[model samples]
Target: MATFNVRPDIDAAAEKLGSTMGAKREIKRLPEVLWEGETVEMLATGSYGGGTGLVAMTSMRLVFLKHGVMSQTVEDFPYPKISSVQWQGGMLMGTLTVYTSGNRADIKNMPKDQGAALSDKLRALIAQGGQPAAAPAAAPAQDVGSRLATLDQLRATGAVSDAEYQERRARILDSL
Candidate 1:
């Protein structure tokens, strides 16, 4: 459960989220992504009125959850995965933008004091170094024939969309 510093204004919520967006959703169990020793630090709710959600942080990971009247979206990023965090606005309300190597999330409508505190925590953790991600295993180099066969199978099995299938097939042919 989160204790909000500012009482949220329901009528100010965005059309997509509805006026009652921030109403609590089930969070009785810890998310599976939490590591054994992780501890929750900051917990906040409501953003510059764009929607209602929770931004929870641990020593190693940042978790975001948007709860809507009918839908909920959740995202998690380890400190090592976050390339940067941006703070916008001041004291009363603002936004925090977090960037990863390949993705970005703009967490807005936060109070200035909380935002600054969260930013400091994020920076400190990042500076100290974060949990290292396991490197992906490299795929063995395959012959052109085998690569083409794999692409064909992917297309047939609907694992690859049509455009991707065509592009891959063309690339494989060009390689040969």
Candidate 2:
């Protein structure tokens, strides 16, 4: 079975996965893998909207993994979901404001050293505006019609193989 949440941030001596996550996960560590295709570009640890955790930038999405006392909250916001991204920070700390299609969130109290750079990177990403196709597995579930169209586009563009497309199509249909 595939392991979940085995990020590089966790100590090697400890388990790579966390109990707060999936059933087959290796516990006692922060998750390393956010998604199958997610390639982490930059990561910064700090307070995200009053919660303590890490913010990771990837080639495909902007991911926020927050750790609570007993569980964790993970948010992977693709560029398509974001309408605007603003970085407000000082030499010590700052906030990242994001406006999505239906929601707006403020990821605040990020360290200046890492936050500023991450904010800049996020700005650049948001400016790029949307990936070519549908959302990843880690992304929040989108509407069925759009999702299907996205899957088709992915297959046509050679981004996903026929088998993968079939699997995803089955999953989408099953969800309905």
Candidate 3:
């Protein structure tokens, strides 16, 4: 098992869901598939492609996990790769559809409220250019001369168009 940070609200929600035997089992298996710095934003249980699994929305991606007696399956959708999400609610449950470039996944039988909330959050994430709001780490400063030389080389090789070169050159100069 692995350990990663989870949002406070998601943790509380997970605890409530963990009271069920199946949910507890799935929750315990969550850490195994998570990335080192990934944070779980939301979680729900649903059926996809006829397999029942846990659907988790994390800081960087969406994941579906199913553990059988001797086998386990994991499917992940990175934020940038997702095109859109759709939610349809019924009396007691809802369906979530996630679309990517060449594929789509339908997760059904999710709790109505959870499905709706997840859809809204996913939409917000997509609207924000699929990036979570996190402070960027400070990058090591490079010498202005070397930066300009690199930019010039790129322009010479036609890697960057003239307009782009001009814009970048101006930006580099403005930093001085």
Which model, 1 or 2, shows the larger TM-score?
2
- Comparing 2 and 3 by lDDT, which wins? 3
TM-score of each: 0.53, 0.55, 0.68
Tens-place lDDT digits, model 3, residues 1-176: 22212334345558545223345445555654665356677888888876788888888899988877667789999999999999999999899999999798999988888789889989999999999878233232434554566567656755457998898779767866
Query: Candidate 1's C-alpha lDDT?
Result: 0.56
**CA RMSD (A), model 3:** 14.9
The global C-alpha lDDT for each of the candidates, from Candidate 1 onward, is: 0.56, 0.58, 0.73
lDDT of 1 by residue, 9-73 (tens): 21122111312225344121122223334445565554523555766666568877665656556
Off by over 4 Å in 1: 1-37, 48-50, 131-176
Residue 33 lDDT (model 3)? 65
What's each prediction's clash count? 2, 8, 0
Model 2 agreement with the true structure over 1-176: per-residue lDDT tens digits: 23322333222212321222222222222233244344456655555555666666666777777655566677778777878777788877788877888788777766666667777777766666666334336443444654566567657756557998898889878876
Q: Which candidate is the best by lDDT?
A: 3
- C-alpha lDDT of residue 168 in model 1: 69
- Model 1 C-alpha RMSD vs. true structure (Å) is 14.3
TM-score for predicted model 1 compared with the true structure: 0.53
